[model samples]
Target: MSKLALDAAVFSDAAVAPDTRLVNDAIVKALRALGERWAAPLPEIRAARLSGTGTFPLPPESPRARVETIPGPRGPVPVRILMPDGAPKGVYLHIHGGGWTVGSARENEGLTSRIAANCGLAVVSVDYALAPEEPYPAGPDDCEAAALWLVNEGPARFGTQRFAIGGESGGATLAAATLRRLRDRHGLSPFAAAVLTSGCFDLRLTPSVRNWGELPLVLNTEDIARFVGNYLRLEGRADDPDVSPLLASLKGMPRALFTVGTRDPLLDDTLFMANAWLAAGNATELDVYAGGCHVFIGFPGTITDQALKRIDAFLTGF
Candidate 1:
């Protein structure tokens, strides 16, 4: 990538922290290479979600980490429940990201454990159904089931009333959708807070999505279209607020923390959502990390450290 071209690339966001530039630039290369070797989309999605689970150095099994399947509306929903050694604060519901087509609760053990340990919050990471096979309501449906189960069972199982839902990328979108489901249909808002990281809240491609089309950063907008296609059927209009929570009324929504990189394709999604969140008279913190890109929090480095601090601070209010 030439200096001028690289500067124009999604990875070129000047806002990225200096310490993060080195790693982010390399990951951009890796993602581009990954995108080049396209095969069957389904297998790729499955493999993408599963690839890092085995090798990522995990903390020695925190006595807190355990796996269980909770019953969903259709059937059982598998989940990985992580407990803090001190816990007793509240429940932090987690959904993993894989563009709604891939990702599992088990794959999120590292982050879940870290959250549970650092925040002193019991973390129940939901293993919601994925897309292309499950599609549309399936992912949100399972997530809803998990949220409902947590609201009812959390006090008894985890011993707290405060509940927060969060996820990264596609998982973050489901988390938002889950909140909508809980609020609109059930007339409940037991959730105290939400932490969303680099999510595409507008499947409709209303504004920023199109402006940043096909920029090869960590995520390709073209690939985003594929993920969206697989996740929603034709009848599932892209504009449905259920699919794109940013389009929904933010009034009465829980206070939220949205983190995204200035260069992330979804950058405007977070910014727009945060502004709307405040417009709806809700508390929101929009943390735009410098020189960061989508899913930047997952990588190790000073920037990740800074982002975690922000997340921890957000949780403090809850």
Candidate 2:
């Protein structure tokens, strides 16, 4: 059964790893140090200079479809739309993960293109404004606007009735928040499904947050706290369901495919959200990679090959 498969996936990493506890401790220490350095608020001038770094390499000869700029409250937001060479099955709006503070559509172009090519779907990768500059609601708002534009325009532009939303890390958070906003504000559910990978669903740290501190993964509690601090101006708002979709009521949302690595600090957040969705009578599928780290699914041809395969399979079904 699928449940048994999921359990095996969750535990497989533990079965192979030796001295996981010791490895976790060293990971925590290294992450703490990185957190301290990244905590320094860079000037807008300096941040812009470093913006292009850490981006994923683009695929060679991947044809660029059309680049569109939509007006955001602050300014025009650039979105890279990638289309398959042939007719597409559906469309997907992708948000790239970077803890809500770093990373951009450019950095994730390769992954987005790969998804489009493999899934036979048109992908619109949005470059939303980052935090410490735009802050809460701004980033999420930009995403909502982009999604709205797509729903309103995609029918004529792409000739597709079915649509989906997806993202990893902070991008995943935006996707979930955008879904909630669309339901509440527009009274429309345009997406056929959604994919959330290693999402930080709960802004208010939970028990799982503490456990992530003990994992040897790329993301740590300290980095997350710093991300939260940059994204949320008011501390009390951290628990608001709009900011933290895990706390939101999961009624009338799209069917979801949740992915996470066992070593990812956000593993529990993904599990909690998926369980909540299922309990709410919504269809939910989960793929947990044992010993996989945060955003590992983005690393194509790497340890995350199986995870990406599962995603392709899930999206194809939709």
- Kindly give the stretch of ten consecutive residues in candidate 1 with the minimal lDDT sum: 1-10
* TM-score of model number 1: 0.89
| 1-318: candidate 1 lDDT, tens digit per residue | 001112334345544566687876777676666556346566654665466432123334556778899999879998988878775588899999878876677776767788887888889898887777788888899999999999889889887898888999999988988898998999999998999999889987635566767656667677678789979954566789999998998789888888887667777787777788778888777777666767888777787888888788777667
* Candidate with maximal lDDT: 1
The per-model lDDT (C-alpha) reads 0.78, 0.77
TM-score of each: 0.89, 0.86
Error of 1 at 232 (Å): 0.5
Q: Residue 186 of model 1: what lDDT?
A: 98
Query: What is candidate 2's CA lDDT for residue 284?
Result: 83
Cα deviation in Å at residue 200, candidate 2? Answer: 0.6
The alpha-carbon lDDT assigned to residue 193 of candidate 1 equals 94
Judge candidate 2 against the unseen true structure and give its global Cα lDDT, from 0 to 1: 0.77
- Tell how far residue 81 is off in model 1, in angstroms: 0.2
